[model samples]
Target: MKSDVLFTSHATAKNGREGHVKSDDGLIDLDLTMPNSDSDKKGSNPEQLFAAAYSACYDGALNLVASKEKKKIDSTTTADISFLKDSEDNGFKIAATLHIEISGVGQEEAEDLAQKAHQACPYSKATRGNIDVTLNPKAV
Candidate 1:
């Protein structure tokens, strides 16, 4: 089957220090900037984009799974994604940590939903064996 939706990524100046990405519909557009040797960054980077996508995707997955289980999520859900550069490999590999906060739920309930959402998320499936991802579910 074909995709339900398609996104086009077009970047104007990615080779330079700063660039921006735009989707065909302008729904996904952001400026990207790289950190210099001093570790200073101005605009968002690719890691930030990945983090945002993961968080949004995970949130949607959680919502879908919760609804399927006839559970009501009265509060908001948030994801804190951390991108870690492999020191051993010298940035050749990347590791990620995802902390999901599900409000209006107990720790056990939150964790259960989070685990199910991880299995449901496309991003999670895409990065499953490719990158090391640590998931921490929190009730807040």
Candidate 2:
């Protein structure tokens, strides 16, 4: 059951964690670095980039679900990605908390929509059972 590829993005990174990354489209060109409490170097990290991608994707999925349900929704989704210690592998792992706020909807409906969006979101499907993902949906 292989589906045709709809889109592909190309990006290259140099020097691992303390280098630069650039996309083929030249939209994302940034210096990369590890998270540090003391260093004030201006750079972006992998976690931040992943969070941004996930948040945008999840929001789009939510909108799609709402449209299919014949509901108009104004929503804002925030993905809080955390880099945590992996006890099993002695490495780092990531977890996510997605907070979604939808205007002009009831709390229960918002929560239901968020759940459906999670099912449809590609990121959520990719990270399912592999990471800890919490969904917090609210009507605002």
Candidate 3:
């Protein structure tokens, strides 16, 4: 197997438990705030980061799958990712919804291609059985 390119990032303290993340390639600039237990300000935490990453990765994977299947997928594909709270664990949960508007494909073929994409997508495979995912195709 060929070696893959490695990426590195560092997080610096912004102020009082908050920080900013910077990648070595200068590509990412993210401000991170810790969850405040006292104030109950737990929104936009790590779960949101996970959701964004998973959603983008899944979309790219879907595009690659479509290309390999000789299907045309353009800018019409939309993906929404939701991160919910796990009541039992008091943690976060993830759910993904995908809508594709590919032209010249029947519903059955589109569904099959989507299923294949879901299986082939790395993020989908990684989160399988852990998160709820919904795939909808607007092609007919």
Candidate 4:
């Protein structure tokens, strides 16, 4: 059987622009908001979701690739995933950068590992050929 994950979630709009979302088990519960000019607005948007998922997926991919390659990574000290919005035909498109730190390996090795991970990451696979994905030696 194929490995799979089952998740359920629901979101409701409190107002015209604000909403809340929670998963079935309540582990992922957060307020959702549309991006606006108001800096004081509270809550997260889809970009945050994309970044979060990408980071986790990339991290898992890194570990899996490293294990297969016989590389030992001591730890992941830091990770930064950024979302960039630019003009698209319909409205806007989101691009991302995933910067992860692998402690046990040197710069070159870390970069190589990240690249391998990107190739294997499910998130990466899903987004492939649709958007402009920059698989930097840095962004897994």
Candidate 5:
């Protein structure tokens, strides 16, 4: 069986040199503007969108991985994805730090599950060679 998910965002002009994006879900309303043409602002601009997408995708992937490993993860898994600029180029990097706070699971077991989750996550795999990922777990 195959499944699919979809999301949509639309942009409209806000001013002379700015615009705003509104999604159907209304979870994000972002402003599009140039921080500076030759500064670090460009790479920093699109981070919020990336972070939001990465966090949600990683969590879902983690849940699947945990299930496959016969582990249970409830509503306490948290993820923080930070976008950092590459010092050598005019580009950016991603740092995904995941915190899974669950009961009835040991640190070793949780860590092992998390490693599998990271490997299974589509976003993590897609950006593996291009980005940085860090997983942190807190046992409850």
Candidate 6:
């Protein structure tokens, strides 16, 4: 169960949901806040950060899969993450819906690529059994 490590990232957060977070390289320094619909908070939340990372990671995986298959494609992926109540554990949980669009491909082909990418993506692998993720692929 051991693998080679290519790279590692470092970051730290303080004061829970309403504080500050910064990366070691200062590329991701930002304020943190709880997701609120009524309050005008000028900060980011964990769910948004996860969505951004997952979308980019998934897109990269999709490209890698396509290159392995000898196909080139233009793609855009949007990860919609939702923080929901975990009734069983009385805690919070997250779900994701990835909207994947691939140019120069049919619906079936796009879906196939997305499915393969999901299986290959690191984020997808990490969240496979821990969270629910839905993939919606479209040809554009």
Query: What digit string (tens of lDDT, one per residue) describes model 6 on residues 9-52?
Result: 99999997788999999999999988784667789999999999
Where is model 6 more than 4 Å wrong at Cα? 37-39
lDDT of each: 0.75, 0.95, 0.67, 0.69, 0.66, 0.94
lDDT of 2 by residue, 1-140 (tens): 99999999999999977889999999999998888746677799888999999999999999999999999999999999999999998999999999999997899999999999999999999999999999999999
Over the full model, what C-alpha lDDT does candidate 3 score relative to the true structure?
0.67
Indicate whether candidate 4 or candidate 5 has the larger TM-score.
4
Ranking by TM-score: 2, 6, 1, 4, 5, 3
| Candidate 3's TM-score | 0.65
Q: Which has the higher lDDT value, candidate number 1 or candidate number 6? A: 6
Question: Could you tell me the TM-score of candidate 6?
Answer: 0.96
List runs of model 2 lying over 4 Å from the truth. Answer: none
lDDT of 1 by residue, 1-140 (tens): 77766765554435544777666667776666865445555577667777878888888999899899988784344444455567877775656677777776799999899899989999899999988888888888
TM-score of each: 0.75, 0.96, 0.65, 0.74, 0.66, 0.96
Candidate 4: pairs in clash: none
Give the residue spans of candidate 5 off by over 4 A.
Answer: 1-18, 24-27, 32-45
Model 1 poorest 10 in a row by lDDT? 74-83
Tens-place lDDT per residue, model 3, 35-129, is 54465443344545666676677667767887888878562455676657888799976687877666657777777777887898778898789
Greater TM-score among 5 and 6 belongs to 6
Which candidate do you rate higher for lDDT, 3 or 4?
Answer: 4
131 Cα displacement, candidate 4 (Å) = 2.1
Candidate 1 lands at a TM-score of: 0.75
- Model 3 scores worst on lDDT over the 10 consecutive residues at 8-17
State in Å the error of residue 76, model 6.
0.4
